[model samples]
Target: LFKPVGLGYASMVIVFFCNTYYIMVLAWGFYYLIKSFSSTLPWSDCDNEWNTPSCIEIFRHQDCKNASFANVTVGDRNMTLLNISSGLDEPGHMNWELMLCLMAVWVLVYFCVWKGVKSTGKIVYFTATFPYVVLIILLVRGVTLPGAYDGIMYYIKPDWSKLEEVWIDAGTQIFFSYAIGLGALTALGSYNRFNNDCYKDAFVLALINSGTSFFAGFVVFSILGFMAAEQGVDISQVAESGPGLAFIAYPKAVSLMPVAPLWAALFFFMLLLLGLDSQFVGVEGFVTGILDLFPSRYYHRYKREIAVAICCLLCFIIDLSMVTQGGMYVFQLFDYYSASGMTLLWQAFWECIVVAWVYGADRFMDDVARMIGYRPFPWMKWCWSFITPCVCLGIFLFHLVNYKPLTYNNVYVYPWWGEVIGWCLALSSMLCIPVSLLYKLFRGAAPVHHAPTPDLQTPRRGPADPRAPPPTTEAAHFVRG
Candidate 1:
């Protein structure tokens, strides 16, 4: 079996690669948030230098006289600003606005997590709650707009035939939402006290996350309905997906609203908070994995602060390529390969195998019982041992078999060399497993042999016992999985 150190190292690799580009998204959010304060949003019309003659303004308000609201001429300017370069081959110079935003984002992330949970924990009080406030406000405003009912209905209406094509996408969304195989969840979990009722916490977190997602759908679709109505197009035509939806369609939708800048500012502020919340957590997870490798190394004053600074600086330098004129292509490549569903499922499958089959699921249940003071239902044991790993492996293989080249708005497929680079990004993280295994094997590490099944017969150990593990926040003995 791979040691905890090896697993932790692998987790760090995943987080580092994922976070590097992931935070670039936050930089975009910062740019939009700053831009939203203007009387005329940059994307609200075709007047900007970045816009082409073909650019069409979709804002339907009487105040917007650039073109008839519904007359979309011959052009769609959804991502024109972000995708100024023709393609990945023509990576133009750095976008100083976005570059500065990226630097600011990295700086903010560093300060938030430099002190670890002490500072981040406090910040979550605002970051975690503020999005919901904005979403609520948006939902209320959205439902009042003309054609809002159409949008909400379109959002809630089931499309059965699409399931065959999109079920895998849905699964991937679930993984991303919960941060399933990411070390951030595990790193955050490590801080819990031994008897802190994590089982309950897990259920609550799942509910909240899923519920928020469902609720946000209303906020989004309602606005999309308004956009479609303004453009005299079906909701599907105006319901742009991905960054186009967030950066273009949604901004234009808000610009037509009363107090346009106010609503736009709130929307982008919520986006910034959401991205920062995720960003700092991912950074913290990587930092924790590194610090744990040599706990003694952090004994010096401000060592953690220095470590976080270095991490942000290195990642910022590496990510500078993504803030260039062709940065969107690079960003999409990283998002597709580095944090793809395939990589996530691969990690999750192995994690389940190690915990359930290798270490024994019944024994794990016993450990949980020891921590939470009762045995969970037996079905959860079956899930850990059989159900989850099989599902992960099945989906992993399915994705591999059906893999497609990355594209931009389904128009520009990445070149063969670009695809090769994407696969390399993917393999960089997945290779950690075999690399760790080979290292252990070369060192002549013995395969672990499990003892008899745990029947809750052993008494808990105390801090005074030399054999006991370190104490938890609640003073209970540490229980290693």
Candidate 2:
């Protein structure tokens, strides 16, 4: 397929928006990780300053009005600590604790990747493996808990209606998990030797990624079941998804375990590592994309460090809004729009067209055969050529048709202007594709005569190859090497 520089640029833009808000989750993790050092888990009881009269103790889980785990009870409504603020309009002042944690996270990321791959490689040894160890420990403990079986059963049982409703969410999860259209994998993959068996690596990565998710489900639901049983509630009542699950339900469940603080520490530490690992790749992708734009000019003179620092600082500043009392509302806005499933699907559709239709799926297979010594499964060709694009386009249209305004905690609907701003965020990245094309078309591009050589001994030049494309653009330079 003819490589479109804008598509690459668009992917980088998506990564930037994703990394900006994504790292804020790590700050929350840090806040909880630090709090886990306490004699008792802060959210385990309704005794803390943040707790309200509606707060219910974890062990005495009685259904209050609109009750949620380990938080306030309003009339008959139960609320968690997460919903303390009435809505987006009430975003109070900055939370100093979370702000400090956000800074700490950025600093950690800057230090880890400032030296580029050297520092990143060393840290991955721990960041990648430690999560599995914690997961295993948690899974073992979760299974042996009083109501673990109930949780496991809840997880295994399928709710067809719920699945139908959330199919788009499931698609987005797959894209996010696989790093599709993010360019992080593309940037990282560029580091490999030309002859590396990426075909094999792709399958390995998918298997491991999906396997980890399935295994982690057991760890989560088992504890959730135990919480439900302890509280004399249904698993559905105690089990929450996303942030509510991580910050509220799971923390409350762990508090009931023996040595609650230790369990809390381990769980949050795992989250910290997971967030850090993702942050590393995302930052690296963004940095690598930016630096490569100017090739030979910025490889020295501490340029990489400066780039990393500036990126971290900018994201940290923008993230300040998320640490406010009303920050969760802001977080929801970003999460719902920035790098969302719709944006990803739009990108994926174009990618499939460029590769499978415009570029020729047969040619791609041939290229893969050249690198891996054999073509991949024939089914792959069908997937790229027809199945993938059609499916993405179909689901994307369905999502658009059924779209609703943003809401928080299933209440507090966002204002019309808020929805406008969210669409702007989504289009900011999605528009990069067409914008880049127009830029290239108006600026005029030299057709690539051949693929770029991989030799990196020279700054902008590679070993002579008749098949190599001229180094006219950043993408061309990348292809050259």
Candidate 3:
């Protein structure tokens, strides 16, 4: 839809749309945190409606007059648990209060990252590290529960029959977790000093990310085990994924623990921090990309705070759809379609092709060597030129062959038009490369040139020229040549 306008604008639109969803998710974490404090056991029962018999029974002894639980009705019967639905959909109304919370989150994010790296960098020291502390706390508590071992066993014990599926899922998870094709990493790295050892940084970050994922599995399963034991159900019965895991099952488990309110608050607060960290980087990338497109003089004078505000405002307005009664439906659509495996694989494949073929891998290595004072191993070049592209292409083709229609809660099948819209969303990111290339070709644009360094411009004295005069200075060489 944005093709005719320009690639830069299209990129901005994509970034804005994606960031709005991040904002919505961050708001969700805050909503749960606020709810955690209002009630001693907010997730004791899925149904929050005070008029309901279950709600009355659950809260009769406690102060049941709290306004937070007053008018909330159980909605959307797709993922029913304990006689309550996901509360994501309510036939024909918008969740105006949730919308307000979402707006508030956008405002918070604006201030957190408005100063760009200077502010966000400091914030990351906490936002990034605090999750581990919370996770460890939860892990300790989880393992101490009666049936926590069962949950951990269930999590680690693999089914050999599902090996192929496991490999595919693992690859997809790693790619997304590392934010490979989202352009955030690239934008963040651009701020680093030219001679920084990005090679070392990449490995360290990857290890940290993968390690956290591993540790989190133990924490999640241990709590899930406890839930299963308490309910007299199998671990499989209590296990859930995505929003079901975060918003429903996990909260339910936390409410059963001692000092439930405190645990819930800590857990939800950790979630909020993690979401904020992700949003900080995403918004930073969006702002950086826009500034790079505009004049450098304007960027210097106006700086990023104004751009940050405008982006936040626009994203807040766009994200209102998610706060509606059908907002979760829209959120699911965006989640399944945008930043999907297919799109990421497509982007990765093209990135490999561009750097390894079009831009010349050998030349890239030369630049890297100049910056880092040592050349990368030959294996990296081979991976860039061949292995990475092949793997990406293979995974992408595999996904196509095994494509399934999008669904919600494994029950609500999206309509044909909804699936079409999803395909369009997936294609939006994939088409940027080819569409922009075609546009440039049609406009007769020339490839960008990188001027040679002064050292490179000066010719080295050769053994064949032993009788020749001393090598000329760089300035004299440039003047003469």
Candidate 4:
């Protein structure tokens, strides 16, 4: 009864953390895209408090605090607003090392996509996946840092405000971060044998994603501590502000270091590469959904090479804005609307309606037993039917009760138009699910999910009823004896 419920709960949590980590990865990608064309380092003493006093005198009147506007000094002159407040104009204010890391990441991503879907499949052995490696690296490096404990302590030392904040953040993070309902998971699942144990695989993937985030605190936080020590400030002050932690905190670290540019590029590059994995998956999800829905579009045109090429062309066209200065904005727009809250809520809702109510629990389980060769526990059964729907419904209700747009910096809100467009695009992506369900329902076409059960040819014995006069002759003989 509760087996599916547990799956729901676990999938939700895993999805949430998955989104958050991916955002960090996105930031890293942004760093490298910038680094590729730049001649000098993006950050410099030329842009900060190190700038001379006269330069600072020019923009002293501006709202530097809210603006993150700052003064810098270089060669006997103070330059204010030359750089601005703490980090780059970009949120998360990343560094070189992170940027370099992002480059390596994207290069791998591009290469993986270059050949087509099959190539991507081949790369999965190492490239199309491998975040766990970076995550483990973070765990080790984080705990070893001088002020590692502070980040961990602070992370959970919640203010009630953060609960409200994190709740929303967590929801959105899960929606955008996870590629489940968007068709990535399903499409990926398609690659497995018809009877592949998807429920199990989903659970494993979700665990890996969430568990890493929990552990990532040590890696991410320790670095924050390292930053704090250099700035001679409390850990809280230098701590990651939000999902933008890497971008903002990392740059400051590079700034403090004597030989920063090299490290800065590397760090930011790594961050960029990390994003490619998630980003490509996101792209792939839509591609798969399209191919699945409109068979004629590929019309058996879905050859891996041809399909991959077309998808690449489409991605290039859509992603062109990412190459521009406003690319970050595009990423943010996608991030806000395509959040886990929205995706999972819808996934949970429809998955329930289709599997539980539409197809029937017995049928669903039969499918599972057929594919996986064993029945899910009662709990698992219940979740696909009930728990997942409840949680998803709850999240959707929460959003309707309280929703807001993604803000620029901490305070600047996106316009209503941007919000509307974002939601529209987001809604369009999830539409396939309902369309599929309706088609299956109306056409009576919910394809049989499980393998056909082989009929038993021989008569099976029921346990003898002890209450019955079992084998009267034998009993009588025994009594007589």
Candidate 5:
């Protein structure tokens, strides 16, 4: 919608809202860590008597505390994990303390990136690397636990029956994990010097990213295995994804380990650092996009620090909704719909088409050669032209055919209207490309020629190159053409 002026601000606004939930969840982790210091272990405080007769009959456990079974109804209709109520509900209530922590995170993010890349660059040196240190420490500790091997095995073991779902999940994860549909990669690349070897960097970073993800799986599942052992339940019973894994399951596990407070603090702090790095990059992408579109004069007059602050403030305000009692529902909705794989697939397909077809693959290669002193291999061109688009299109079609309604914890299926709203969110980014193409086609009265200019003739060795070129009609025609 803001294409006439620039798409930078629009990109920033979209990213801001999308990442706000990440910030909120990170804050929730912090809240749990801090709360752990004062209260009894989150798992150990369950009531002696079962609140529901069904729960008593099913599990036959004296108390709900320290149990792997999460569906046991405790008080009212609420289910308990480690005696903590699973606050997974529609229009769920707000958490004031967590809201305050989220605001603090916003403030911290603003201060960290307010000065722009210089500040963020330095911050990333620590934020980016510190998580690995913590992860290693946790991994070392996690593997030492009795049931850790079981957890690791479960994480790596493939269920052949679920191969189709696995492929879909893997594809979606690869796309997001590499940060591909989001313009963050593009925005980050824009900062590189013209001569930077982007092709080389791409492979290195991709490998490192994939490796980190693989490493994290062991750390996470190993810990969950220990938790399952402690609770005397199956690893599958204790396993959860997303917020449940970070806030409820992991924290409960940490509470069981020796030096619980220290480990809990370190774990949450690692989460904070990891989340901060992502937020920093996200904000940088937004800011860089705007600055790239606008002239330097305008940027100088407005000031980047102020621009960043405004972005942060707007994000903070908008995210307040997600911090409300019912905010998890809102957050889940955003996660389910916004920046979804379908939207990403659509974006990637069109981007490949544009660069490989509309923009001309040969021209793109020439441009790359000019910048990096060597062109990418021929296979890359083929990949861009055919393989990429076909894969993206195939995945998108497959997803549409196997479309599943959004659900929370296998309950609370989104209403059809809600699903429609989700589709709108997903399509918002995908629609921009076709809309812009149509707008350009209809708005223009004349076709624009985009043929490359021919290389200029070298000047005569001695001097007076103009005189030499003026002699021949062919030369003149070539020069003019």
Candidate 6:
């Protein structure tokens, strides 16, 4: 129960709540999966075929021109949802009860983190691997569908003109998907065995992650295409929706299938597992970073639980805005400012600075080489040093040029002060880097130990290796534990 310092324990406060929300959504994904197997499931009553060129049909169809027709039938409720009138109904307010429910969700997340990373680390083992399993299942099913190829073409068939538009999205997706630059990479990098092959591990992780996203498109689009074929509608109509793609779009597809409910349930459940690992690991980074930067801040005390409790309370309150349909608004704002384009740009820039500029490139490369038994290629060094910074800087400016404030109810906008408030909020955890450096400058560097920072960096240690290869003396230069 160690207490954090400062008048406001800002970063901790943000992580506690934000991470909680993220995991809750992930849990919903899991819940959906479980519901799929049951006869009594969401949107299960309808037996109507989903759409014309079914998702599977579209995925499998390479010609993109023709498809075998599936008999068309549409369910009652599904039709009602798509009706024009359904779109106009406005509660125009937030749901207090759900907000309170969110509080409970946050509390559950906090309890898991009570024991810190040691406890949290165990949970990631299951959460991280399950999504891949689900993806494989979906991929197998999708590829067999007649129209899946058409759906996949829609995903990777980039309009080069739209590349600039999608560049931010693609970059943002990479950033959020991998949780890069949000201090997670930096802190995690610190934990690596000094000479662990980080580059290889990174490549492998990328391979797996990107492969999942790409393959997932096949499954998702195949189903969509299947629905399209069943409904006699075009694929464009299906792709136009938002999260509705999950809630409305996919459920409709299931209803048309032989065992619709079961598939829906499994798909959602898989989402939960993926999200659970993502949120917990994110929170862990925040927790580890705080402890690393300010050892005395939360020294033994009852403050840890207190911090957790406070986060739960605030999350529900802020999230209560969801009742008004503003919940999505609030989420979108936080998602954009806290974890979106701005955040990634900040991360990419800062990380490069920390390792390349502040710490020095040769030293950083030396550590990377030791961990994996090879140094970064010349191109990598150039990217880490010169190219990355410029790219990030340019992109970050684009974020500013396109800056739009988040509104409370699509009317009253968050003030400029609110943007300041948001940035200060996100930057709180990183205060340690500069503060620690200042302390060293004034008091003289402390003796090296297991830590990977300046006082400790004779060479090696930090940024936990997910799973890497054999190492020698270079491992000591980066990390061993």
Query: Could you give candidate 2's per-residue lDDT for residues 256-277 as a string of tens digits?
Result: 7889999889999999999998
Q: What digit string (tens of lDDT, one per residue) describes model 1 on residues 352-417? A: 888887767887788788777888888998889889989999888888898888997667889999
Of candidates 4 and 2, the better by lDDT: 2
Candidate 6: clashing residue pairs, number? 79
Task: TM-score for candidate 1, please give it.
Answer: 0.90
Candidate 5, 1-481: lDDT as tens digits? 1243213333444465466566776677667666667445444344433233434322222234444344342121222322222443444555577778878888888888776565566667687888999999999999999789999999999989999998987887688677676677667665555555677777887888899989999999998888766656678877777566776567667767777777888888888888887777777777767666677667565487878878778777767777765566567777766766776677678667767875578777777776667988999899999999999999989988998988756655667777777778776666666565566568862321233122212221112331232233322221111
- Each prediction's Cα RMSD? 4.4, 5.4, 9.2, 13.3, 9.3, 8.5
Best by TM-score: 1
Residues 1-481, candidate 3: write the lDDT tens digits.
1223233344444555578776777777887788778655645654554224434222222433433332121122322222223334443455666777787888888888776676666667778888989999989888998889999999999989999888877777677788776776666666655555677667777888788889989998898787666655566655666766777677767766778888888888988998887787788878878787777656455577788889888878768777665676677778777867777777778777767775578877887776566898989999999999999999889988998888766767777877887778777766776777677668876532233334433444123533433232321221111
What ranges in model 1 sit over 4 Å off?
A: 1-6, 59-80, 295-298, 448-481
Q: Is candidate 1 or candidate 6 better by lDDT?
A: 1
Top lDDT hit: 2
Question: Which of the two candidates, 3 or 6, achieves a greater lDDT against the reference?
Answer: 3
Clashing pairs in 1: none
Which portions of model 2 miss their true places by more than 4 Å?
Answer: 1-5, 60-84, 439-481
TM-scores, all candidates, are 0.90, 0.88, 0.83, 0.67, 0.83, 0.70
User: Which lDDT tens digits does candidate 6 get at residues 207-254?
Assistant: 878887777777788877766655556666555333456655676665
The Cα local distance difference test for each model comes to 0.76, 0.77, 0.68, 0.50, 0.66, 0.55
**lDDT of candidate 4 over 305-380, digit per residue (tens):** 4555565454444444333333455556765665446755766576676668654787667767766678888897
Model 4 alpha-carbon drift over 4 Å, by segment: 1-41, 47-111, 114-118, 128-145, 241-243, 257-266, 294-303, 430-481
Model 6 misplaced stretches (Cα beyond 4 Å): 1-21, 27-108, 144-146, 188-195, 240-242, 293-298, 301-317, 323-325, 370-374, 402-481
lDDT of 4: 0.50
